[model samples]
Target: MCKEECPYDFRLAEVVSKLKEIQARKVLVQLPNGLKKYYPILRTTLEDLEIEVFLSLSHSWGVCDLALGEAKKTMCDTILHVGHHGQVALYTLSDIKIVCSPAFYKRNPIPLATRGLKLLMAKGCKRIGLFTTAQHLNYFQELREALSEAGAKVHTTQIFPWMPGQIIGCRFDTIVSNLDRKVDAYLVVGGGIFHGLGLFVTTNKPVIIADPYSNRLIEVAEEASQILKKRLFKLMEALDKKNYAVVISTKIGQFRLALAQKIRDLLRGRGKVAELVVADEISPSLLLNIPWAQAFVIVACPRIAIDHQEEYPYPLLNPGEVKYVLRGSLEEYTPKDSLVPNLSLNNVA
Candidate 1:
């Protein structure tokens, strides 16, 4: 029998209902790389239906990587975006049937951090800001109550229009806008170091992650610090590079063509040689052709510069980091507008 837990037992009935509602015979299914394990199950489940299923085999990190274009290219009538929320970045497409099925992983016995109570007490962190991925949102109330009972003043950023306490990798606007000044530290309530690290970088506050699977308290300071140090080193190294390629994405949400052009113009004014490289997808393997450039400034997803810099041959800094390097000061390093477009800064300096 198929388990009902998350990572399993995706209801085929809903997909059938949606397909029938829209009268869609051809469907395109897009899953984040991690959830691709469900591809076979999903395909098999849909085999008997009156739908033609096509799995999107593209590289997708977040909503920023939705396969809308691929769906259009393949002439799919409906798009099933899995693993994340229904909030695909593009805004203008109401013509096609777009179904967002978020993958869920149920945590029974409630993965509350009772054992980590001692660790939390020891950290000397009293005012805590809580954040998490959407998967663990169901247990937010229990987890918050548990933390509060442990004698810590807990706060979750809820200003986001999406799920409360939810911090997606690219957008930290929810945390930035909703957090009170009294917050001394952050507690991420899901697995993985990515969201926690992003929170730490954006807030410059100490972050701890509560992994549901392990139910252990993981301090993200050391790892986040190490990554930031590498970025700083790269920035310092690239400060002297005269030739830079400002990369822009052609995707609907990730596009920053104007920003890329602006950066290129700024570099030229500063007596540096610069060029703009436009592409739909970015990767270390994809960027290998531009060997003539000494450095590359990314106007794509902010995570590329944060996480994938080491993958590249040369320095790859985001717009804000590039500005910091060029100016050589943290005095005015406000990355209000980063790589991802239509990103709301809302006066978060």
Candidate 2:
């Protein structure tokens, strides 16, 4: 079972066994929207084990609210949070058990035959835009230089504001808004279809996704490609569309808002329309004046608001660059993003 090609094949059994060992009476299960498709199987598996389960779904901020709420209610003896890159906080457990599935896989190197990259190079791809899951953001600099030497320009926006070291799944609007129209195509160097699909949803131009574990570039197949094509056409038709606004807040003594301002300047320079709504703590109603934005971006130091109990209604955008931020100033803390090769399932939990 451990050697199964698809980890899902044996994961439930393993989870059940672990729960039994802990004598877990109740369990909490949290997942992102992307993984909602698999909830039926998960629910059935937990019920078979005779464990009471609570389900919570978050679009971007993984496990933060669910974990906190579970902690307050003392509702479960075990917790399982899935569909994230393994950044879990806001829940403290001295005795209760907690487990998380870090969906990390190694992909084979991308082949050079993909039409998107080929077309991009032909069109003189001097500058490139990059975004990824929060855990992988540390590698962006190396990736940037790699693409630069490959003759592509590179730019990255710390999209999520509140959680710096985690990926903000819901706040992809910032990435889309920051797209360099001057660049030939967008490059997403992360796992799964979500990252690629997010960028694809916002632009008609080419998007080259390099997931080393998946070993394939997401391209438009004749059938599935039509959906991507339609999405791209819609985004292109909506070009120069300014239907959204974002409010950025910063942590005390952290430079998150400064970086966000820089990103704002970059977006404006590219001729995209955007407005800085508010940069301070305020009610959700503060956004009422912005004319109903399509999305919002939050920029703050890692773990700043994790214990603060602040809440917001909009989707968040975290940069996943906490290590870099901390390394530049504080020396006592080890940056979580340090390179550790050949990541396995154990590394994620």
- Best-fitting candidate, measured by TM-score? 1
TM-score of 1: 0.86
Q: Write the per-residue lDDT of candidate 1 for residues 1-349, one digit (tens) a residue.
A: 2434435334457766665666777878888777787687777666667678999998766666667788888898777777666232222254556776655556631445544444656778788887667666656778778878878788876634666666687767556766847687888877778778777777777777877766667788788778777777777778778889998887766887878887788778777889988888888887898887989988888888878788988988777665554554444433333332342323323
Model 1 CA deviation exceeding 4 Å by range = 1-16, 86-94, 112-118, 180-182, 213-216, 328-349
lDDT of 2 at 278: 54
Q: Taking the candidates one at a time, how many backbone clashes does each contain?
A: 0, 16
Clashes of 1: 0
Candidate 2, residue 194: how far the Cα is off, in Å? 4.6
Please list the residue runs of candidate 2 whose C-alpha ends up more than 4 Å from where it truly belongs after superposition: 3-74, 86-101, 108-119, 133-142, 161-170, 178-182, 190-194, 211-214, 220-225, 228-349
TM-score for candidate 2: 0.41
- Output the worst ten-in-a-row residue range by lDDT, candidate 1: 340-349
Query: Measured by C-alpha RMSD in angstroms, how accurate is candidate 1?
Result: 3.9
Top candidate (lDDT): 1
